[model samples]
Target: HFGIVRFPQKKNIVFQELNYQYSFSDWIQWSMKIDSDQKTKEEYDKKIILFPEKKQIRQVDEPWFDMLLHKATIIGGEGRLGRNNVIFTLSLAYYSSGYALETCEYNMIEFNERLHEPLSSAELSKIVRSAYSGNYEAASREFIVELCQEWVAPELKNKDLFIQRKGWWKFKKPREQRKYSHKKEWKEDLVAYLSEKSYISKPYLTLSKKDLASELGMPKRTLDKVLKELKEEHKVFYKVTRGRNGGMVIASVKALFGTIIQVRKEMQQAYVAAITEKFGLTGSFVLNTFKQLAAPYKQPEEVRLFTVDTG
Candidate 1:
């Protein structure tokens, strides 16, 4: 709706109009920057949820909320979806005495925690009610509509009613359950399919279960069963999301120097932790390995078996 409002008359630009540079170096550099920005945003977003507040109180979720909102504000410095929606939701939830939003600070925290992620009206309702410790399930959606109407802006207040009126419940189901979970025999087929494609991110290493199942051509339930078998057999490591629901990644163990170590899996963790732990060894080890490998692979001189040089 926002995009439509802003660019109603403007046509979508095509690749030809994008004025893309043709140099490999420029393209690679640009791609890397985009990938880096995307990764940083994802990491920061996760951190916001995990530590919503900064100061920890025994039996109080205040500190976690503070941390989340703070991080959300920092990331949403550009005033994009992350910041505005987070602030709006927290403000609304807090005003409604949502248990999840213990106070204004807590509400702000949750808003930041859920930034940029789409939630169905039902899911939003569940989250709002869950904010409070006390159970308060109403007879109908009237309470939720009123809460939103009172809390959010005039534009956003009626979003719940809009969602319900438009039959948004149909889209609320977990993606994996709705799509995959229907068959059991497609495990190997799914793996083979995923293995064939070179993913922008690592395949089967750290993606969501839904994403992996989609790649595998199996139901999410079926994928779960297969993943369990694989993890038990030490065939692959599916990395689950932390805090909020995260995806799974396939961590294939590699035999290096008689040691069964997950090269990619371990390194990814080390890389993530290194950002927090400057003394961490993961980043250093990978860097050293790259340097060592590059030196040997470099060609000092070129030899021609058949030379046709005219002097």
Candidate 2:
């Protein structure tokens, strides 16, 4: 996404997840998530004759509620879970109608199987069939509310007003996970990474602003600032050669020749750096060391090698 520099303001380029409102099918698909996750839990079951006073621990917990809360609109996509009845049956039934596997398995098992308490097999079969044949929405909210009422216990049925609500999910504001970092921290991480990759004092190689900035999750201007700072120190150099095969490499003869040589051998061809300077082998010792390595290795015609002033 290109930033709006002058003429226009940069509107939010990333998708804001809060805009989404879940539908009945969305509720159903999420509800039907498989309960694979299990861990030991110790709860006091007063009715336990063997250990009424003691806590009992066993693998018994469902991770269904932890699933992603995205709305599913596709009739086919809604019904294609590996297996898990996540939200509630009314929604599950609506989606199951579209699922060939769910509908085709038994007369009315798709929706009925997901229920904690099953309804009448005969009555449910006929009703669900109509929904399967493209009448899912037609299966009114009243039917869903009634289904909830039927499944609940006789004592709890007194809360008829509460039963009016559909599905298992409660109305709570969603929370978005955010990672916090200070500018100082970001600069530190970038410096450390670049230093580690370039072998510090013997710096070599760097990437294009567009590519490296994006890879490092940083702004190009910030990268430029860091690199410019290093260049002013005269510890490194950003050199660009001429001709068709020419390109840029950030290096310095001020750095140890052995260190620079070792980096080329161990590190990647292109380094992730934010340092720059005016570059060349100026020091006699640093220059001769590189010349030694390049000796018996004549410059390739296709690729321009260093200029050695023998005089």
TM-scores of all models? 0.22, 0.23
Q: Please give the RMSD to the true structure for each candidate, in Å.
A: 28.9, 34.4
lDDT of 1 at 245: 59
Task: Give residue 196's error in model 1 in angstroms.
Answer: 2.6
The candidate maximizing lDDT is: 1
Q: Per-residue CA lDDT of candidate 2, range 1-311, in tens?
A: 12354443347344545567688777666655422221112233434445234332111111111111122221111112111221223333434434453533362354345444444565344334433444333223333333333333223332332223333434543322335444455556555555556654446654555555676677778767755665554434555566666655654423433354344433422222222123553454334444543321221123322332111
Candidate 1 stretches greater than 4 Å from native = 1-185, 197-204, 254-311
- In order, what lDDT does every prediction score? 0.40, 0.39
Q: What is the lDDT of candidate 1?
A: 0.40
Clashes per candidate, residues 3 or more apart or on different chains = 30, 11
Residue 233 of model 1, lDDT score: 53
